[model samples]
Target: MSKRKTDEVTGVETTGHSWDGIEELNNPLPRWWLWTLYLCIFWGILYTIAYPAWPMISGATQGVLGWSTRANVAAEITAHEAANAELVTQLVAADMPTLPQDADLNRYAIARGGAVFRANCSQCHGSGAAGAKGYPNLLDDDWLWGGDIDAIMTTVRHGIRNTLDDDARYSAMPAFGDMLEPAEIDAVVEHVVSLSSSDFDAALAEQGAVVFADNCASCHGEAGLGNREMGAPNLADAIWLYGGDRATLHTTVEQARFGVMPPWGPRLKEADIRAVSAYVHSLGGGE
Candidate 1:
């Protein structure tokens, strides 16, 4: 048994751990710090016992409190839905064209519809309903189907060219790539370009006019004003869903476009669909 050495200068006990000429002092920890550490350990044990802390094979252990974050969130959502129930009913029942006549109901519908649009429609139409490259702008009067409130609602419900819904607005432009000769396609592209812009070859556009009258006039109308019933876009309008450039027109003539919109009728409630339609109608472009 080795006797613990003492530091002669301080009269304190030594741990007998030495490096070079220095020796380690056997000092006691501060009482306050030691008490704090003990309290922390006790608190941790209490927390584990009172709350969901342990993981079992099946699931996490539900503590005595029986509190759950998911349950709390679900409860909150239910409360909000209940609060808006009356308004939702009114919105669904209200005449869509004359909805704006009732200021309060219209306001509520627009606000609720805005939220719905942001969640579902914003991915394609944008947050401000400005639209992207391929997507048609909601803030424009150039609707391929129609821009009226009822028309907007109907479009939302059934969507465009979608196979899932039987009543989906279906329109198929013939992919002229296999049908038309390269020269004929080029001529048609020039004519289509001349409809919206002045920067087009006159001779080519003249040749294309014959081609347009023979093939495209049936759906696009004699003056390229488009048929809403057929969902054909007006070529005369500067607003283009794809693009108005020469190259874009060329591609459109050759391959054609088939823009598809998923039917919201199956996914969204009638009230929600109406609300979003109202919201879209209020975006300055609706007729």
Candidate 2:
């Protein structure tokens, strides 16, 4: 081994390893820093022994303490279920129409129904229930069926145009593509447009009036007002389901618009159906 040399100016010892022009100084590491490094190693060893740290071929090693995030979540969920058991039981058996009579139940139902609506109904009706082209707006007074609480509940439970459910609300607008000529269809479209507004050819509307009286009056009434009992929408109103534009009206008249709402009764709990109904009814449009 080579003997260590002292630097003249600084009086520091050389590390005895140097290049042709430079010598390295042998400096001692700070005590605090060395202690901190040792403490980190000790802590790492403790952590490995106390918690899950090692990985195996198939799974991780279980530490001394029996802790699992999945188990904790399950326990919390169980506790929450237990807490809501009584309310859920009451909601399950409660009369749908008289739900609001019990203030507490109604309040809880609305809150819970909001969550259920977001998860289930929001996809079609929208999160705010404003509705899209095919879907009916729940926030508006116009309803294909009645807008009463019981009516909403009935609709939610049985659904509309759901062929699978025996009690589903059913109706069909006959497709006039095969029955009517192009001129006759055009005349009828003009007549339907005139009933709502004068945004059509007067001569065509006059010709179409005869067609409307003969073909549409049976269900849509002589005055063009809708028949709720038959599920015929009020055409005279500004609000429309599939829209009342010329193109949309033509498509509706020719092909006939038949939208389907899946029955929630088969999918959700009884409590959930009631809850959603109540939530919808509270949206300022329920009669």
Candidate 3:
């Protein structure tokens, strides 16, 4: 038979359960532990009273402090705006050409521009400014328009192929399908392809040169070198805007693909536009 033991300090009865000769004693919780638990409960009650707490029919209780998540966000935004006011003012006052000279202002502009580019320009001119086919790569030195700071600013302010902007870059490559015979376009394509390589057939080039001089030479130049003012691409360069294949050239001559980019000035803030233009200008071979 096992015997039960009572706790001498509390005069409480034993649990009457024993394990491995160790008997369980029914003792009161320690005063300190009990007080700590009570403190937690009291703190919870105080927190409920001081902060937004119980849900009602329509909404939760507005605590005594009247604090809200919205208020906290507004306060943070106000503080940030206050701090950036001087920088914003300086950026607005400065012109695009002079932005890069001011190191602090340029850094600020790039940061602002990066965000705007990610949101707007990243679809075509990727996040890193590496463009897809038909879209001009901002990273590369090859610009359809002039590559200067003022030129880039003008391009952004008035988008290319945007009919909405009356002053948009309006010149386009006319479809030679209606203008020239299929055989002639083919000969020109072959001649254009040959400009990049020494593999051109002299006889065919000689025959095509007459057709090119009459029709294409005005925009493409006498030697097939592109005209920037007319947005005509350089024929001799390895970097091709629309692929350098025979089929692609045929399609370009047949349909005459014109790509369009949106103007950022109307949608984005001036500082943000400046920053993005600077960032694009700083890309690989951007000068």
TM-scores for every candidate against the unseen true structure: 0.82, 0.73, 0.72
Which candidate has the highest lDDT of all?
Answer: 1
Instruction: Single out the weakest 10-residue window by summed lDDT for candidate 1.
Output: 1-10
- The residue pairs found clashing in candidate 2 are none
Candidate 2 lDDT by residue in tens digits, 136-208: 8999888778999889998999999988799888888988888888798899999899888867899998898
| Model 2 TM-score (2 dp) | 0.73
Residue 136 in model 1: lDDT: 91
How many backbone overlaps does candidate 3 show?
A: 0
Q: How much is 59 displaced in model 3, in angstroms?
A: 17
Q: List the RMSD of every prediction in angstroms.
A: 4.1, 6.3, 8.0
lDDT of 1 at 101: 91
- Candidate order by lDDT, decreasing, is 1, 2, 3
| Candidate 3 Cα lDDT to native | 0.82
CA lDDT, candidate 3, residue 92:
77
Ranked by TM-score, the better of candidates 1 and 2 is: 1
